[model samples]
Target: MTELDRLASDFGNAETAIALTGAGISAPSGIPTFRGDDGVWKRFDEGQFTYGRFRSDPAGFWADRLELHREMFGGEFEPNAAHDALAALARDGHLDAILTQNTDGLHRDAAFVGDDSPADGITDAADATILELHGNARRVRCTDCGNRTEAEPIFDRAADGERPPTCDCGGVYKPDVVLFGEQLPGAVIQRARSLARESDVFLAIGSSLAVEPAASLPRLAASSGATVGIVNLESTPCDGVADVVCREDVTEVLPRLRDLAASG
Candidate 1:
């Protein structure tokens, strides 16, 4: 059988199948991946995104954040074929959950959660099964009050010369992303690890599998006897160990996977 056919068969038979995505999945939607020649990381100072720097200079943090917004989140970006295919898989019950490292919020925007989901008929509590390893960029949270809100208004204010927006509770509002030097949320990590352990099929897409802890999930699934598949434009360290490796653009491969899943 072809690699895609094998993946389709495994997915069709698996009790629990999950996908892990990174910035590469969103690249087709016009989002730049980190470390690319024209990536946001190259445009800004690395230290500016660290939690320590933000704590020391809140105003400066917002200033840099404004630039970041312009570079990354300012444009109109929509979910590409890759995201739509995954959503379809989830809706059809061929996929159980999506564990993503992307902060872009495209997965959520693709209507991963809603009353319109086909999975709602399968289970009463059916909701978008998403585990965001990194927090969403479209949201802002008060550091002290824990109030979360849409990030556009704050970005607008910042663009209008508001150095740093403040919350009604007098707390500083920061983008709800896991910045450098900040620990990933413990609860989210635990959930991801649990999913990895329980998954019968794991698909790692558009990620280099370079980031720590998050990268380990695929390995965990593999070790637990899950069929591990990876799809990326570039080679990853796990390619040698992955049960299936497809070095193709996610936008192209995922739709085919979705089609194969639908055929069966």
Candidate 2:
């Protein structure tokens, strides 16, 4: 049998199947991966958006960040096949939890039917089935009061010449995303650890697996007796330990896995 078929068979029978997704999953949606040939860093300076820069020039940083946001999220960056497949897997009960390192809201947007969803009979997710490791870009947080709002309004204000959008409490609004030199949310990380430890099957999809803590998850699952699978375009540090490895396209891989699992 093909590796994907075997993965599907295992996933179909597994009680708790979880996946950790990375930038590669979003690449097909026209969002650039953080590394590799056409990475964002290659076009923009990573130093310009660091915590240090944000602290030194909040106004300029916000303006620059608004531009950066336009550059990143400007397009019709809809969820691609890989995303829909994961959502379908979760919807069909073949997948349990998803731990995504992407700040893009595609997973949540695709999986959960919100007020904007057009699909019929798809209810909202009652639990935290998808955990964001690096926070979401679609939200804005107040620096002073810590209240968050949708980023669109703040971006609108910024576009209308408000250099840094301020909250009602007179606090500056920052993109809710975790910038460089920022720590991942502690509460989310804790839950992710528990999920990894409890999973019967763990799939590491499209991640470089070089980043710390996140890179440790697949290993954590394996150590806890979960079968670990990895699907990525390039080889990662965890490739040596993964029970199943696929270097094919995620768009093709995830959908086939979903279909096969459902049929099984």
Candidate 3:
């Protein structure tokens, strides 16, 4: 049998398969990643996304971010075949949950991919649980009162003229995403750890496996004896330990897995 066929056989028997995804998974949807040549890093320095920078120039920082998010939404980026495939796998009881390192909310959006397009099974979308490691961009939080609000109008008006908006508590309203040098929320860390602890199969999709804390999670699952698989355009640090390594376009392989699950 082919490697993919063999993977399907193994996947079919897994009790709880959990996915760890990174920016690569969202690239197909037109979201730019932070690293690599011509990435956000090359265009803007790393200091741009830090809390210290935001604190010093909150208006400028937020204005830039708001513009980017507005472009992301207006770019008309939709879920690709890979996203639909993962949703399909999740629906068939193969994937227990998807733990994503992305803050773009693509997986959350991808979970509902078939709600509009009836090609993939619509029933499985509801059963999928997306565990976002980084916080989402669709929400804004008040730094003082912790009151949260939707990011639509906040971003919309900001894109037009509202430079920096404040919350009712007189605190700056920031995107709910975890910024550089900021600690991941304790609750989110706990949830990711719990999911890794319970998984029988751990899959890493499109991540370089270099970032801290979130990068440590797949290792935690591996130490606990969970089968680890990686799919990325290039090799990663933990490549030596992965059971299955496929250096191919995620959009190409993910659809096959989804189609297999849908057929079964």
Candidate 4:
């Protein structure tokens, strides 16, 4: 049997299968990876995104953030083949959960891949099934009142010289994402770790598997007796430890795996 066949077998037979995705999965959807050659960091100053800067100069930080957001989500973006595959796998009960490091919301958007309306098995962001390791970009949170709301209006407020948009409670609004110097939400990370330990077949897709805490998940799954699969165009730190390593375009590989798993 081929490596993909083995992966399909495991996916089909396992009681709990999870997919851990990173920026690579979103690259095909026109969202550039931060470390890639045409990455956002290469053009923009990463220093402007730290939690320190947001607190020190909210106006300057918001201005820079608006520019950065445009650079990332400036165009008409849609979920690609890989995202559709994961969503399909989840819909068909082949994948129990998707733990994504991407804040792009592609996985959540996959629910509307074809139709404009929500699909049958939509994975709501508020649900634990689709865990966003980093916070969602579609939201903005009040720094003082902690009110979470849609980002467009907040971004518009910032654009109209609110600098850092102020909440009704007299608090500043910030993108609900984890900044460079900000810690990820404690409860979210704890739940992610728990999922990693509980998985039966873990697929590490499109991630370099280098970032801490997240990078440790594939290894944790492997050591916990789950079969680990890594699929990426480039070699990752965890490639050596992965039970199956496939160097293929994520957009192609995942859909094929989805088909195989469904058939089996």
The candidate scoring highest on lDDT is: 4
Query: What lDDT would each prediction earn against the true structure?
Result: 0.83, 0.84, 0.75, 0.84
Q: Write the per-residue lDDT of candidate 1 for residues 222-255, one digit (tens) a residue.
A: 9999999999988998887689999988999999
lDDT of 4 at 88: 88
Poorly placed runs, candidate 4 (over 4 Å):
112-128
lDDT per residue (tens digit) for residues 119-183 in model 4:
11224333227777777877788898787777878888887888989899999988888888888
How many pairs of residues collide in model 2?
0
**How high a TM-score does candidate 2 get?**
0.93
What global local distance difference test value does model 3 have? 0.75
Error of 3 at 110 (Å): 1.9
lDDT, candidate 4, at 82: 98
How much lDDT does candidate 1 score? 0.83
Error of 4 at 178 (Å): 0.4
Candidate 1 clashing pairs, residues 3+ apart or interchain: none
Per-residue alpha-carbon lDDT of candidate 2 for residues 20-130, written as tens digits (9 for 90 to 100): 999999989998776788887788788889877777788888888987888888788889999999989888888888888887788887876443321111123743377
Window of ten residues with lowest summed lDDT in model 4: 113-122
lDDT tens string, model 3, 56-142? 898888877875676555576767877778877887878878877776767767776321221111123466667667777777777
